[model samples]
Target chain A: MKYVLIILALLTVLTVGFVGLRGQTSRQPPVMVFNDLVDQPKYKNQGESAFFADGRQMRLPPAGAVAWGRTPDKPDPGNLIDDADYYGLKVIPLPVDAALLQRGQRVFNTYCAVCHGGFGTGNGVATNYGMSAPANYHTDRLRQVTDGYLYQVITEGKGLMGAYGPSIKPPDRWAAVAYVRALQRAGNAKIDDVPQNLRGELEKQP
Target chain B: MHDRRLVTEGIRVSRIFPKNSRQIAAALGLGVVLFGGLITAGVTYYFTPKYTRVGYTPYQPVPYSHRIHAGQLGLDCTYCHTNVFESPHANLPSPNVCMNCHDPAKGNIKGDSPLLAPIRDAFKTGRPVDWVKVHKVPDFAYFNHQIHVNRGVSCVSCHGRVDQMVEVRHEQPLSMSWCLDCHRNPEPNLRPNELVTKLDWDSAKDWKVSPLTQNTDSQEAFARKMVKVSALHPPTNCTTCHR
Candidate 1:
């Protein structure tokens, strides 16, 4: 009995020595004991497929496919929409409130801050790497441009800029325009613009 | 007790057997019992999904570091995962997204590094890079990223502090019981929807130091209010996930 106990103890130590403790980082895939229908042979989104010629589960949309729902069609072939002035809207269609501006700021920081700078002063992080001529929102030319024109620029690439329409939806684009206007106003703020209650706080700032 | 023939007038029926056969049989029986119990306990301790799936770290074609991009550079999570809010799956970014910064143009960084060769090749060839999927669910399970994110479940709660990990290992067990642990009491994990992507937002640090004080009014208090506001009752039905 003593010998049997000693043999069992040595065997246990040997097994543990070969395989490290649980949760130790390993490159091997997990062992799924009794994989009962856990991994079926059905196609998954963005999964590999053996049946398809391209070996991709996701199929690209057929050529010239017209969208049925309220989806935006393909961007104009060469930077020219049908109604330039009409689509280049001067007014924001949505209600301009604090909530709208909050969302606009969130969207702007996520999508545009890398290239356009957080303060919209043409000094974004991308500019340090070689991004040339990110438009400064504080400039007179940008301040005077209509909201629709800004929307169009965001949807279509100007010069070396890329189109962000596919990523940012339409309402978000309008909100971003509103945020750009707010940034411009903030950059050119004067003492008179401060509210009477907050004037003391503004004066305290260096 | 065994040698009755030596004690009285009795015949020795099995002289070929060993004198200490009983003790030998008893020792063998006890050994079998001990080994049986050890095997049962070992299997129960080390052979489960929690043990097998916890630390599965796989190698990828591109050695992209979340520590650098998401942590040091402070890029928002949604910059690459654009469709997380809209789709069930948190889709991977295409190679074109990588070119936005590394395109060897006037001010791009590391345009010609051999490490980024696969990304450039995929971008030029219009082919997808074979990025290994980490954190996968069973085929029968239906996990939605949008509902969880939109309801203010931070990614850090499920995937530990990914920004700190050089290569993200399977931080959580992601077992069925683990899911129930949160579903039963989700207040601890809840935060503001706007700060869902803020992986490093520490409540105690923010409550004491942050100026804005967005949801700094005690984490439990905020989570309780959010539960009331969002009607946060995650179902515990097996069909909820198994479907």
Candidate 2:
């Protein structure tokens, strides 16, 4: 009986020791539990800062700071327009190429495809998810709009459409404009648009 | 007291206790202690939030049914989560996005249902709906959705079958070790970029059709080869997640 009790006591000690070895709860570490950096003395954005003379966290730019690279003062080459046509530009200022169209397609797929289907038919899958039907690019009205106008609509957003300017860079937006034009042209492709060798096969699709 | 028997005795002490009752009582006590310890550990292990969070469905402002939209109708995950590929954060659809189909003016579908009151209110008021977050990591950990997505990790890898969920719930224990298990060996989970949004996609089935794996002997070998070709290297260093 004594030996049994002795064994029980030893087992209890072992179990307790094993449990103790586990230390504190593993969920929350204790190393930096009460670190001062979490509650450090700091100024919030645009808040008052005692260290600064103006007492504002936001500092004004230096007096002679002209914005660098394609400065607003550089006279936009008269491509940009400001009128009732939704401030739509009259001409595309950037150079266009196959790479730019490819980039535009990628950007359009990533951003616009949810509303403007992959084929730009305005029948994107989002229409089933309780969204309004987006405008189709194949329409004659949209086709006549200048490239600048398309860029402006993409930049500022049109009607119920939200602006893509914040997410899409300006160059990519231009690329998208170029791609939209391509889609519009593709929608109304003439027999001449097809290659001479492929025209035979195209006409054979009775 | 007289029941004490020395261990050095030549004869095997078959009966140490004075009565069977005492032996039975001792056994019962030991059994209780062992079972008690086991029960305590078992309850602690199973009842902790980490383990229990799997089915924790929280109440949301709207009763949106992912099962109806995603399962029955088969809308892609990216239809609403528009910026999942380009941005670190998955962008929630704006009220205008909902208005695309549910516009009261259009009267297309479900325009008058009271269940869609909040959506209509948000659209009319230009206010955002407050959708509660289901899966959350510790504040210290940094997660970028775009990087994981671009690397061919499917949305279902961590979220489970969200299409079938009426209301989304926590599916996986977002623990450090749970992440390490995948980061250490990501080959099995890797899929083609096009199939990332396809929740029920099977890499094995794809092997037979894929041009890359047509000449390969088996699906397993092809998957491993594709993993090597993609150059997927999910880092495990602390700075990868912490800093």
Candidate 3:
């Protein structure tokens, strides 16, 4: 009888211990409940603020203050996009290297590819959303527009397009511009653009 | 004679209290059984997945069904939630964005329906539709939609089968441990960057060779390679989300 009582106590202890461990595994309530900022009363952009003497959340930029990383609007002498005709200045203002072009390709695919298709044909999936047909980069009309014109359009949106100035930084924007030029050049490339050996091999194909 | 009578009386008194060893054993048995039953019930109740708001389908202003749009017509998640890839907030679409397709000027596809009256009124008045936000994490826990989307996490990763949901509900617990499960090893959930918006992207059905490299490697291999090459460095430190 003594042994049976001892066994029962041991069994009870084991069961209680297991239950305690299981309870520990369950989620404990956080020390403080989550403070939902969205639901909190706050001033939105351009919204009225009683807290501030000036009734607006957005303050005007100081005079002569330029945006971060943007060069002055005045064209630099060495600037490749300055007064250059479309096909005239083939060279990129920034150093042209394999890495720069590769980086440009990535940036272009992320931002520009939605409106201008992945292959620059302007038949993006965004067309389904009732967006007006984007211009095809392969056309001679786009090919004739200078690189500066493309940069400006991207900076200050043209036609139905919204400005991407805030989202894409200046350097990345230039990279996208470089990528656009590469796409056009590739679209209009001749057989001579291929290596001499590769051209012979291509001609061999019946 | 007196001693014998006293011993017999003591035994009889003890029997009145506990009856016999059989009765005492039965009472102990009952106590053990009761203890076991309560403990089992307690563990099952506390540990059940049903506790963490699983089927909490809240009613919205407009009964916009993801089932018809995403499942039937096969509209991508990105069509409406435009900034999922670029911003932390998966922005609710303004009425003008909705008007692009369902404008009265354009063929009023479903415009006249009473269900859409609120949308029409908001569009006409330029007042925004009050969309009820689902799947909101705690304000203190920072979740960046862009980082996850860009790093190859799909919509279906956290929002299980959103395409099939008629009315979206909270599926995952969104708990700290639930998040840590993915941040620890994110290989299985990862996909190619282009397919981030594609909620139904299964690696098994349409496997392709890696275009990133010239060599012929499986898509899964490509994803694993990307995890390394991108140097994803998903921080496990507390400050990553808490701060």
Candidate 4:
């Protein structure tokens, strides 16, 4: 019994010693450090910084700032009106590109059509949900506005309309503006003024 | 013979009584101690951080060095990963976008480190240059790069020193608390409206440019300015972070 007691006591002491050592060695605090580059410096010239970063500075390339890669002599379809101020607000011009127009159409269908109706008649799903009726693109007020003014309304957003600038890319926004103009023209086109190629098709209608 | 018998009797008594009890008790006690010790050790190991492998480290494609681009070149994170301020994605620039400059610059280089090779291959094959994502949170965690970037959170806040890193590694734990710390209290680095568009300012010369230069009194004026220019948005509500 005495021998058993002595053995048990020795085991207890060894176990306690092991645990004590483990406790002494196990704890560590996580290390956190801040970067100085982001902290101290402000970048001055974007183009210079681009070059310094081993990237090229595109200054007066063959194509202008708006022209992605179209030929200069071809009267690049991407160049639209350059009037900046329209309706007392600074306006961004829409690029005259088919692809951009298509992209803009897609974005409009996804985000705007739900609120402004697919044809921009102001009767969207949100209309029943307390949103005011959006202005119809076919209206004389919108048709009279320049393409620049339309671009501004789309970029900066008019009253009761949120800015689509953040939601859509600059190019895509321009495309949407083009599509809006297209919609307006389609709505206002006279039956007799239909294109010769399409007059036969329209005349065939009952 | 009697002495021998007595000696035998003494030996039996010593061996049978105290010694046997001691041996049996010692075995039982040792068994209990060992079993108890194992249980304790197992419990401790189970609760310890060392045993858990929640830390994820995934392998990437292309070995694109952020250190060379961001650190050495001093390129802004927003340049390539454009739309970080206005959109949800800190989008990887398209291969064509990369080729825009690289194609013209390195026309002479032929072999590896030819700067334009990856871009050329992408253009020729029509396959996108697949970049491995480093800082991926779970799908359930809806994190917007725009809100954080616009609201004064530096790229290094979550991405760590990406410019300095040769290989981009996930540095932050990227837990909810990590996001909330900044969301709850935004920094003063919130950029002004004009500065937002004019991203390539020469920092050396324009170091003293402050967002709050115009002095307009009244809370309404301040509010209007904030709405028009400041990047300060609301907190991370359920819809803000989750949706």
Candidate closest to the true structure, highest TM-score:
1
DockQ of each: 0.54, 0.10, 0.09, 0.02
User: Which regions of candidate 1 are displaced past 4 Å?
Assistant: A69-87, A128-133, A204-206, B1-26, B105-107, B212-216
Cα-based lDDT for every prediction: 0.79, 0.68, 0.67, 0.55
Q: Write one digit per residue (lDDT tens) for candidate 2, span B1-243.
A: 334455434235445544476778978788677667766875565544355445557777788888886776666676578668887777667666565456677524687888888888877774456566666555556788898888878898888888888888667766688889889988777766666777766676766776754566665664577668777778999999886
Q: After superposition, how far is residue B216 of candidate 2 from its true place, in Å?
A: 9.8
Worst 10 residues of 1 chain B by lDDT: B7-16
Clashing residue pairs in candidate 3 (N, C-alpha, C atoms within 3 angstroms): none
Q: Write the per-residue lDDT of candidate 2 for residues A1-206, one digit (tens) a residue.
A: 56656766686676656543222233222223454653345543234466765445556656544443435454232223222233456666678899899878767876677678888999876676656778898888898888878877776677767665555667777888888888888889998998898798789776
* Model 4's TM-score against the true structure: 0.39
- Per-residue lDDT of model 4, residues A1-206, tens digit only: 55656765686677666543221222222111443531234432122233432342323335443354545544334334222333343333444677766766655664566557778777765555445567777788888777667767665666656555444555666677777776777788788678777788788776
Candidate with the greatest DockQ versus the true structure: 1
lDDT per residue, candidate 1, A65-177, as tens digits?
Answer: 54443225643432233335335578877798898899899889987888889999878877776677788888889889888888888777566566666667777877888
TM-score of the second chain in each model? 0.86, 0.78, 0.80, 0.58
DockQ sort, best first: 1, 2, 3, 4
Clash count list over all predictions:
3, 5, 0, 9
Give Cα distance to truth, residue B31, candidate 3, Å. Answer: 7.7
Candidates sorted by lDDT, best first: 1, 2, 3, 4
Ranking by TM-score: 1, 2, 3, 4
Relative to the true structure, candidate 2 has a C-alpha RMSD (angstroms) of 9.5
Candidate 4, residues B1-243: lDDT per residue as tens digits? Answer: 989999999998987788568778778888787668766875574333222212223444455676765565444465466567767767776554444224443221222345456666876675555454445444455677776556544565566566666766556656666667656654433333234323343223343554333343433444345645765655778777665
DockQ of 1: 0.54
- Compose the digit string of candidate 3's lDDT tens values, residues B1-243: 999999999989887777576877787787677667766876565444333344556678898899876776566575567567777877666565555445555434554678887789887775555565556565567788999998888888888888888888767767777888888878877777767766666665555533433353665686678778998667899998987
TM-score of each predicted structure versus truth = 0.88, 0.65, 0.59, 0.39
lDDT of 3 by residue, A30-67 (tens): 22234465235654423445665544454556555555
